[model samples]
Target: MAGGGGALEIPERQKRGKIVRRKKKKRIGFRIDLTPLVDITFLLLTFFMFTTTMLKPQIMEMRIPPEMYAKVEVRASELLTLMLTPENKLYWYKGIADQNNPPQEISISKLRALAIEKNLEPTVKNRLITVLKISPEANYARVVEILDELNQAEIPITEAITKEVDEKGEPVKRQRKFTIAPLTEEDLKLLQGEGK
Candidate 1:
């Protein structure tokens, strides 16, 4: 209630009128422009592509074993040969293929003892050679039993073997020599059929 000058300041809200009420209602479409986001993503991808260290670990080339091929050679002197027959009989022979008579026709217990003794040998401590003679009449059960007995003894043996068998099932004499069979008749027939 002073002199009425054109300055009317009743309340702070009344001073700001229609201009404040209808300021900018459309909100400028709230653009958030995904183009910049895309550009940033591409920039990050490019940065990673150019600056990242794609480390490739080095590898050594190894000579892999092939099927039907032996890995190592077994020496005669270092081996304790065991001959297993088709009748579940086992024979023990050592060094230069001598007459294997002492531990002949051995059962599981005898076989185990022989294997343990050979394994315990000072020279053949690591190398216990057991040659299993499998005849055509031999059952797989016997083979498994022999293997299980060997496993029970905890003595490792090799299948790398030299076979010697007589046609008459007689003992191989000192004059007798060991030779590997070249091929089976079935294999020959298959080859012949292929050729035809």
Candidate 2:
């Protein structure tokens, strides 16, 4: 009790440590800058576009006329037939057996006029049209020529031809091939007995 009462001294002062505050740590962050990328991309695009070639193209539009819806008229008695030979001979045949006239050999000039006249008629029977049949043995050039002439003359030609060389020459069992050309000499001689 004496020791406790007599010596109540305390060693003072190296200054007891005050409450220490904790410091906050600094944070690092990363971000991508898109402004420069966008600008560079736009510049490259503009440069490519300016340096590229531009061409002006010309285009033509074509239209095909519709075909007529009417049917073609043909008759044994009324049909006109044309034939052509490799040598450029022309023959025209028309009408019935026995009464059917042999093909007539014709000239291109005269044939042209005839074709024009023939084509000028309406192709329809009651419609004022006439039909001309052609046989296949006819020459290609001559047939085209005749067709062209008919077209120019406004003639409506039909599909028929003078197939035989001469009715007398063959047994009449041969091809009566359809030709688009005009008549030849052998055809007339055979049918009309008019050719050499």
Candidate 3:
């Protein structure tokens, strides 16, 4: 008998029946750390920054005189005048720009050859001065091409003729002497009269 109640009866189970219970294991939550991944990413970025090489810009070198207004007298025979028209036409003449020695139309392709031939002449060598006058309406690219052609024209020099020597102690190559000036009204008339 139970002390708090009347006598308690226990129920009997059949010999073939039984009950079973199993304990469940506690599950742990999944977590991911980003410290190592961040470190690796920074390491790769720094490696690329330190190993990459920067490219240099290509440019042409030009030297300007100290005095811009200073007038330098040059002989008429040593002067070579070049004019560019709005029609992309190029004209050149030796000495002064006049009707007698009128501007002859020349293609830009032949400019280098003509410049070299004139500069190598016995009378004009080392003394020839090139004057380029470009019209405001002329193509800028044509102007640059003309300048590049002139720059590429070089005159060979002998050690005995000139004392100038390059950094390598070799005879220096003489570049074409050139100057830029504004195209005047007279020059335009010359081109128009020539039927160009």
- Of models 2 and 3, which has the larger lDDT? 3
Runs with alpha carbons beyond 4 Å of true place in candidate 2: 1-73, 97-100, 116-139, 155-196
Give the alpha carbon lDDT tens digit for every residue of 36-88 in model 1. Answer: 89999999999999998889875433232354444457787665555555455
Kindly give the stretch of ten consecutive residues in candidate 1 with the minimal lDDT sum.
173-182
Runs in model 3 with CA error above 4 Å? Answer: 1-57, 155-176
What does the lDDT come to for candidate 1? 0.52
Which candidate order results from sorting by TM-score in descending order?
A: 3, 1, 2
**Candidate with more favorable, higher TM-score: 1 or 3:** 3
* Tens-digit lDDT string for candidate 3 (77-190): 998899998888999999875657888999999998888777767787677888888999999899989988887775332222255566899765555577888788989898
Task: Please write out the lDDT profile of model 2 over residues 1-196, one tens digit for every residue.
Answer: 3345445342121122221233544677889999999999999999999998888775433233254444445566545556555555655545442334545667767766665454334442222222343445556666667655545443222222223234577422212222332344544445444533
lDDT top scorer: 3
If scored against the real structure, what TM-score would every candidate get?
0.41, 0.35, 0.61
- Which whole-number lDDT from 0 to 100 does residue 161 have in model 2? 22
- The candidate with the higher TM-score, 2 or 3, is 3
Residue pairs in candidate 3 whose N, alpha carbon or C atoms collide under 3 angstroms: none
Candidate 2 at residue 31, lDDT?
91
RMSD over all Cα atoms, model 3:
17.1
